[model samples]
Target: MTTISDGVTVVDHPLVRHKLTLMREKDRSTKSFRQLLNEIGMLLCYEVTRDLPMEMTEIETPLTKSMQPIIAGKKMVFAPILRAGVGFLDGMLELVPAARVAHIGLYRDPNTLQAVEYYFKAPSDIAERMVVVMDPMLATANSAVAAIDRLKERGAKDLRFVCLLAAPEGIERFRGAHPDVRIWTAAIDEKLNEHGYIVPGLGDAGDRMFGTR
Candidate 1:
């Protein structure tokens, strides 16, 4: 229950914790893993959109017409960081069906451990909307930082970062790089291993989720 000064929100819901435990287990099947990720993604989506602007508007109910509060103002854009980020898409879309999607492809260089961008595509009106960048693992923060940089270069003004697992080092570096960006994560683990993987993390999310490794 540590509150970070860096606008990092650690969602402490019991459902998130329970599913994370299942995901962390090495024996979990690929099918179960993906299913759990979607469930957890839905929960995280709920928490992250809490501050969405709402305006009162007239609406019709089953038996009566009345003014109801509805989401208003800037639209939402979900920028998922390639393959791994895809796992969270269905759940997030279930919450905000009208939100646009942006895809950013980045891969870590094994030798230098740097993030290299492969592809980037986003909505034309990115600057006018709220962008939420999704990546399941925030281990090195290099990809997250680079991805946000690309988005800003393309005129994305409002941005938030969401991930399933994050490390203290990665979170610190990410916050320092973009203090304006809010971070929402399910769990912040101990630290990264020598291989740059979060300790006690769910492992390479893309590999496990896609059975690539």
Candidate 2:
């Protein structure tokens, strides 16, 4: 794994690499496309949570010996940055079933061409626990940055941004805005196109997943 910044981790797991190859294919159908993204997200979640606090717990076993281990915490929050981010939720929760979730709805202002937050919600323990923000595409970094800004305003401090893919431009912008926030992704593309999409990206993640276009 490569560190984009202090906390941002670029996961290079074999599963992520292999699934990403299929995701990049033009022939991959929407059903397969969505499945691959979730599977990849599940794999990526493993690394992002490596530092999570785990406490030893004791439990009775069916055999003569008695021992068991369970996680300890109020619960981590997975806050998806609307639309596409919601796709990674099930995959992430499959690993951390007890975790809470919050949704932040944002859309670009057509006239100003900037991100605007329309809705947001999080657990009361946000500041005390880790927060993982999800968005499959980090193209220009505008929306990702805006999403974090809103999360912070809502009392989230220990924050991490997780995405299926990112472009260099978006990575730079995200880091510049929130140096303390780490990023996790399956792959980081080279550049953004004139229209703000990552060149050679898996097209629009939301469109591909939902077959909207």
Candidate 3:
């Protein structure tokens, strides 16, 4: 992992770079895009959970008993911002099937480029669990910040944000809003365009993933 800043990590694994490149192709089919995303999500998940706390427990083998390490403490919560964020959920869940899910629904206002939330659901004990917020793109960061705001209001304290791509402006905005939270992403792109879309980014992640465009 490449550290872009104090709390930002870029998952620069070869497989992650290769799959992200494939997904960036404009001609790539929705099926291929979704598949690549899922694969990359799994890779990113592995990197993100690398430093999770572990505890030793005794397990019985055929020949003898052995002490094995397992994730300790409360199961983490995977909080995904709606639609595009959902694309990362399946692959992440495949790795951490025991993790809980919290869904935050928000959309960007086209003209103002602000996040507007319509739904939010989470476990009652969210504050006690680590919350990893997943969103495929972090361009303006309005959605990410808004989602985290709602999460904090609901008592979630330990939080992390994950994305497929991010813009410098978005990173600054996100870090400025929530300095305590760490960020994990496949790559940090150039910048956001006039309409708040990441330059050189695989355009409209939600549209691309769902074939809605």
Candidate 4:
């Protein structure tokens, strides 16, 4: 695997670990697992949004009025990598209720090991908004690359990728394919198993999250 380019951020916050611990267990129930994923997603959101633009604004208090500051423009749209990504949307929406939503679906080609897009939908103003792709796992760069490439085609100039877990192999692949994207992952795992699953990973995050197993 290649090395991490300086721009890819890997967050290791306390709350992230706490919630991740809850989700990692085989005993965790579907509801609990899903909730934990949302909690982790919120933390990921905080880290990924650290560089958002802000501007000053006028404010008033019961005792006094003041000119405070707030986010300049919520020119943001959250795009989840389809079904599994949907698991994170609600929790993040709680934080940025006004943000628009988009969805993209990419599946690995069993034979080719490349990402193939099956579906895509985004807000009409996607170009003007900063886009974030949310997924729980990045085992290989294939899916992420394909999804991001589609986003770029639709006019997303500024983009960031947020995920709960990532493998070194996957990150390296992603970095090579996309030098401009800034990746924010909660933890970087050792490597992908022979089947492309992250080692010591929580296991089929989408299935585990929704209790498909």
Q: Report the number of the highest-lDDT candidate.
A: 3
Each candidate structure's count of clashing pairs: 0, 3, 0, 0
For model 2, the run of ten residues with the poorest summed lDDT: 63-72
Candidate 2: which stretches are off by over 4 Å? 64-69, 109-113
lDDT of 1 by residue, 117-174 (tens): 9999999999999999999999999999999999999999999999999999999899
Task: Assess candidate 2 and give its lDDT.
Answer: 0.85
Q: 1 or 3, which is superior by lDDT?
A: 3
Pairs that clash in candidate 4: none
Best by TM-score: 3
Superposed Cα deviation of residue 203, candidate 3 (Å): 0.3
TM-score of each: 0.97, 0.92, 0.99, 0.93
- 1-213: candidate 2 lDDT, tens digit per residue: 877656567798887899998999988999999898889888888888888776776666776665555566767899998778888989999999988998988775646557788888888878887899999988877888988888788788889889988888888888899999888988888888777878788887887889989
The ten-residue window of minimal lDDT in model 3 covers: 39-48
Give lDDT tens digits, candidate 3, residues 8-54.
99999999999999999999999999999888889999988989999
Q: Name the regions of candidate 4 deviating beyond 4 angstroms.
A: 1-5
Could you tell which candidate, 1 or 4, scores higher by TM-score?
Answer: 1
Per-residue lDDT of candidate 4, residues 1-213 (tens digit): 122558677777778888887888888898999998988888778778777888988788998889887888756899999768877888888888889999998877777778788889899889999998988898887888889999999999999998888998888888898889989887888889888888888888888877778
Candidate 1 least-lDDT 10 residues: 1-10
Q: Which regions of candidate 3 are displaced past 4 Å?
A: none
